[model samples]
Structures are given as C-alpha cells and as structure tokens.
Target: MVRMAVHQSRGRTQIKDSRRGCPRYQPHKGKSLTFGIRPEHVTEKRVHTASSQVDFSADVQVVEPMGMDTMVFFSVKGTDICARSAPQAVVGAGHRMEFTVDLHHMHLIDPEKNRVIGHRSDDKAKTSD
Candidate 1:
C-alpha cells in the first residue's frame, strides 16, 4: 500500500497494491504524482468492503443523465473528477453526495516521465530470500 496527498488537499489517501509491478520507479516520499481511477471505479454504490475503498463527500457540480447511467462531475483538490453512477442514484447538482473510491483500481503516474509508476496487481508479489 502507498499513501499520497492529493494536490491542494489536506490529507493523504491510502492506495493498495500501488507498487506491485513497477520496480524501477521508486517514488520518493513527498514527491508529487498523479492519481487516476476510472469513472466507473468512483461510484455511489459501495461494492467492495476492502481496505482500499475510501468514502468521501463532494459537492456535485453537474449531473448528466444518460438513460441507464448518470455522469457526475465534481472537483477534488482543484482537479475536476467524474463519477459514473446509476441514473436513479445520482443527486442534483450543487448537492453534497457521498462517494466510494476503490483504490485497488487506482493508477499512479509519474507526471515528469509521463509514465505509469504504480498500479494494483492481481497476483501475489514474488519474494527472494
């Protein structure tokens, strides 16, 4: 697991399996990196009870209802983020709504290098004694 602070945000969010595959790019403590998660991963529904899942509230900026699903837009630490939700589960714009982000599906990118530095892994890490 890895903990990173979102830019302009007060606290750090924990991400699981962040450095599973990429061994060459070692992110130094306090170094800035990009956090990315698919819109589907950020949802109003809580599917997993894993430790990697985090719950937070954000003010909804816009709501686009697309028949079966809705696209919710909000801002986090000055960055605009979107969430895909069931059409019936979405609240109106300008309202505070709760969201669950599955950090296991998160991707960490090295902004300077424009490369993915870390991500979740489905397989166990191999250890050499």
Candidate 2:
C-alpha cells in the first residue's frame, strides 16, 4: 500500500507484499501514493515473517512511558513518527536506532486527492456497501 520512492536521505523503499500487485484508489485511477503506519505497528523487531518490511534509522527524540506501551518519537524522512514500545524498550532520547515497518499495516493514500487507498479485502467490501 505504501507507494514511496525510496529517497537517499531516508532509506530505500521495499515492496514485499504486492500479492494483489497494485490496485487503484477509485476516482483517481493512479498508483498508490502517500501512506501512514500507525505507531502501534512500529516495532523494534523486523518481522521477517510478515508480508513486507521497511527499515530505517532515526534519532530518538522523546520517550513517554504509559504503563503497558511506551510512546517513542523519532525523526525519519524529514518527518517525525511515533512508535509504540514495550514498558522497557531500552530506548532513550539522543539514541540512534533502526526500526522496522510492518508492510501489512501500511495505510496507503492517493496523492492527487489525499485519500486512503485501501488494500485489504475488507476495505473493498466496506466501500462497495
């Protein structure tokens, strides 16, 4: 779902899933565009068994412990994204760490219309209704 151009400033874009190849986000009829990954899906472990994976290294900016999940803030691709970590993630501000993106959880969007391009069958079913 994440249709990105892999820049050098950040990292390369790896498309592992694409089992459905690439689908259109109706009314646009174009390729996948912007995408978003929820913090909850961001994990310290790179899920090699997952459908796809995206990796990057960023400097930790903040760490907010919230009982079960710790909120981590870091900058990547000139944007700051949060990640949900365990109670003891052994991460702290000013540290550079590599993070992995779970491809199955990517929320892609249509560039022209800034609309989410649903890639799941459930999405298609809901939209059809």
Candidate 3:
C-alpha cells in the first residue's frame, strides 16, 4: 500500500492505495501531478494492413522512478503509452489522496514470458532430432 499527500490551498490530504504502494501528490495553484502505480504495461494485438500482417505490441511504463513522491502522466507515443511526471512531486508522506482509475489497466509483461521467447539464455543444450 502507498500513502501520499494531496497538497491543497489550505493544507494537504493524505492518500493511500493498496495496489500502488505509498504515493504522495503535491499540487500547486495552477498545476497538478499524477502517478501510475505500475512501472510498466504491455499491450499485444494483431496489426492488419493491406500490404502485410504483423504482431504489434505496445509497451509502456513510468519512465521516472516509481516511488511515493512521484507524478505520472498519461500520453502515448506511436500508440505506446508513457507515464511521466511534472516538476512537482506526486507521492509523499501521509497526505489524503484519491483515484478513479482501474489498477488492472496498467499491465506489465511477465518476466517468465521473456525466457520462453529466447530473450534469456539457458546453459542447457538442445537435443538432436
């Protein structure tokens, strides 16, 4: 669970999320910050085109370090989503914060899957046919 503070005009509000861990949001008069609980996300789909067909995957993750005091931005680059933060802090100590986003939307690829795809090397040798 993450605990954070939402800075208000008068003071700040402490917030908490079980899924994302401790996060604090500090708001300014004319600006605000957002943070993503998950560090990475991957979307897999089949891309169809008149010329050819190919597998397309959109991998996204919070570029900045994931911590209690960080802000997240929602923007896509060539269909890829990238989580970014403003100059201000998003997660902090005890401050009340709230969210209306579904944590499930932030999906990351399983590490085990990388091994099966030959991205990781194994010491064992293959058998002859």
Best by lDDT: 1
TM-score (all chains, Cα) for each model: 0.70, 0.66, 0.19
Residue 126 in model 3: shift from native, Å? 24
Candidate 2 clashes between residue pairs 3 or more apart in a chain or in different chains: 18-21
Task: Give the winner by TM-score: 2 or 3.
Answer: 2
lDDT of each: 0.69, 0.64, 0.29
Q: Residue 77 in model 1: shift from native, Å? A: 2.5
Q: How do the residues 11-110 of candidate 1 rate in per-residue lDDT, one tens digit apiece?
A: 3333333323333234333567767789988999576688677788799999998888899999975778899998877899999999988776777776
Determine the C-alpha RMSD for candidate 3 after optimal superposition of all C-alphas: 19.7
For lDDT, candidate 2 versus 3, the one ahead is 2
Q: How do the candidates rank by TM-score, highest first?
A: 1, 2, 3
Name the regions of candidate 1 deviating beyond 4 angstroms: 1-26, 45-47, 119-129
Q: After superposition, how far is residue 42 of candidate 3 from its true place, in Å?
A: 16
lDDT of 3 by residue, 17-122 (tens): 2223212222222222232334222212223332222222222233345453344333333332433333243333233222233343322222324222111132
Tens digit of per-residue lDDT, candidate 2, span 1-129: 234532221233334433323334333333445768899888675546755666667889998888888888887667778888775653789988777777667776667666666556658788899
List the candidate 2 regions with Cα displacement exceeding 4 Å: 1-20, 24-32, 119-129
